[model samples]
Target: MCNEMTTSLKTEVLESPLEIVLKGSNTKFITAFKELLLHPVYSRPTLQFIESSVKLAPNRARVLAESEHGRLIFIQLLKQTESWYSGEDNFYLHLLNSIISQLLSADLGNLFLSTFSEPIVNEDERLSLLKIVDAAIDSLLERKSTTLDCQPLLEILFRDFTTASAQAIPFIRSADTSPEYSDSLLSQLTNIWNRLIVLLDIYQTILDNQPSLKPEILKDNIIEELVSLLGEAQKSLPRRSKLADLEKSASKSSSGNVSDHDDLDPKDFPLIKGKIIYLLGTLVQENKQVQDLVRQLQGLELVLTNCIIDLNNPFIRERSILCLRYLLANNPENQDFVAKMEAKETVSEDALHEAGYETELVNGKLALKKRT
Candidate 1:
């Protein structure tokens, strides 16, 4: 009798439609199946079933992403397997991972993007979606799937950064007056920054591995916008530092003792700053036009200043040095600018000319080179 019951149950599961199992009103079945889906022992078979179902009917899968009941299930599963990416054998996570892989493989980039971008009402739901998106991106990058178009995803990620920065800037500027509000803003900002870094790293990785794709990626103006944003953030750092010092002095005078206000560390902001510099380095590594653009925009100077400001952060320092190295690699004009800026003695135009190299405007920046 036990053997017969087990056989019947397996047959029932195989015959049931995935959509009904996922969004059905049978709470008992849903709850039991959810448990089974999350169980490490039973997850692989369950996930394989789901993957095959989705592959057979992608429209139904997309409808699931669009439906509230389906999204809730995804959110619940995502929360339950928060540590899934750490090599844990959670079935629900495996199922979701497999679904994402299938979607990318099928060249359903727009569907995935649209479904994931659904307007989630809850903050936790939104964050859960973000985490899911991040995992999907990692999987996509790992596969190096050539058929997948990353441009749309890149635009969405860049928009996320710009939107978050716009919201956080007001609070950042007025942080001295409203500490609590500023803390909240900074928390949001940090989350967005972390996501941006992940996305940018993925973007850089794709560009690095595929040389032919550079034209497609660079045509979007994403690099120029990123550089502009980086300059704006760097400009605000000193002002924020000065404001912090003033607030510290005021607190000390009023209390007649140095208040241990270690709540916010100015150093934390440099991690974002460093990531921006590193990304700039990645963008200009092989492109001479971009290198020349960075020179014209005084990006080199901004990077050099950051090297000093973020000296304690080895990763930042290393990236800054690499950026400088790449920027000056085949460009002598930028090299001469560095030399002139560093040297105490004034180097005349005549001296540059006498060195068998004359300054010529290349892409609107003076470059030193031998007369051709």
Candidate 2:
């Protein structure tokens, strides 16, 4: 009798619409959202759902922010538990992470961020939110997923970043901001910072492994997409700063205004700064292959160096310093330009602020000597 009852219940449940979709749906998207809200026992179905959703959405997935249905699905997914592992769920996690990133693209970022409320109730919730933010940064660099449509996503993400950064500031400088989460709120903030750094490192992987990307089309797409992604960071700055820097980078890049470089103003756009530095660093690694696009590349370097001097954040300054170090070390073509910028005090004297500065100096001098 017990066996019969269990079999009957299973039969009825199997007949349910949701279950039918789970079995028949090619994209498995139905279960993807459900898995987020359901138990980890449903991991297999959730993986199927993510695979299908990514297939349907691909690089241009409409961020759930604009689509009411999609938003509902996203909400469900955020409610998931640790049943999904770094092992079994890695594929789905990567896919979900990628989709969230697309959702946070510049065009859709604001909408996504705006949909969430301030002061999440717990660290777990904040960590989930942080995942999406991290994913956006990853998507920006990974697939070069920048489009005019992503601008809104980028805006909201920056707002999220600034707010998160604000929260993190106190903890970053605090004495007790250790790993002691047993009775501290700041510990949560520390977790957020650690997670963000991990995400940035993942994002940085795109530039670090740029040489491994296949197909010339994908490579080209990445370059332009990253450029657009950085462009959105301009919106986060003061209006006057934005407009002034806009006019300046434009004029400087166009007129080759080497003498009066200050004729153009600079903006404190951190995202842009990070993106530019990442791009320059990546390009430096493959400088020889990009000779055909030398003019545009030069313009990009000019803008980057100009922005590097204008950046106030030490982290950003460090990144820019590292990028310059790479270019000056591996790409001898940039030596004269670096010398010129150094002469003009556009790059700081404290090269130690950048990573690998000594190695860069040694390699740069070697490259210069070889040329001589």
> lDDT tens digits, residues 150-243, model 2?
3333334334445544554444344222334344564565455544443344345543544443233234334443443333333343222455
Q: What is the alpha-carbon lDDT for the whole of candidate 1? A: 0.59
Task: Name the candidate that leads on lDDT.
Answer: 1
The per-candidate count of clashes, in order, stands at 1, 20
Candidate 1 lowest-lDDT run of ten: 259-268
> How does each model score on lDDT?
0.59, 0.45
- Candidate whose TM-score is highest: 1
lDDT of 1 by residue, 1-372 (tens): 333333443677568777876566655544555555566665556556767888787556754576555665555555554456556555556567667656655555455555555355333344445556666656666665445566555566565556655654553454344355366555665655545555556566656555466666667676666676567666654332345655765687688775333333442343556767877887787678888888788787777665442421335656776787677667766777765554533434443333234555667655555546
Cα deviation of 151 in candidate 1 (Å)?
Answer: 3.7
Q: Global CA lDDT of candidate 2, please?
A: 0.45
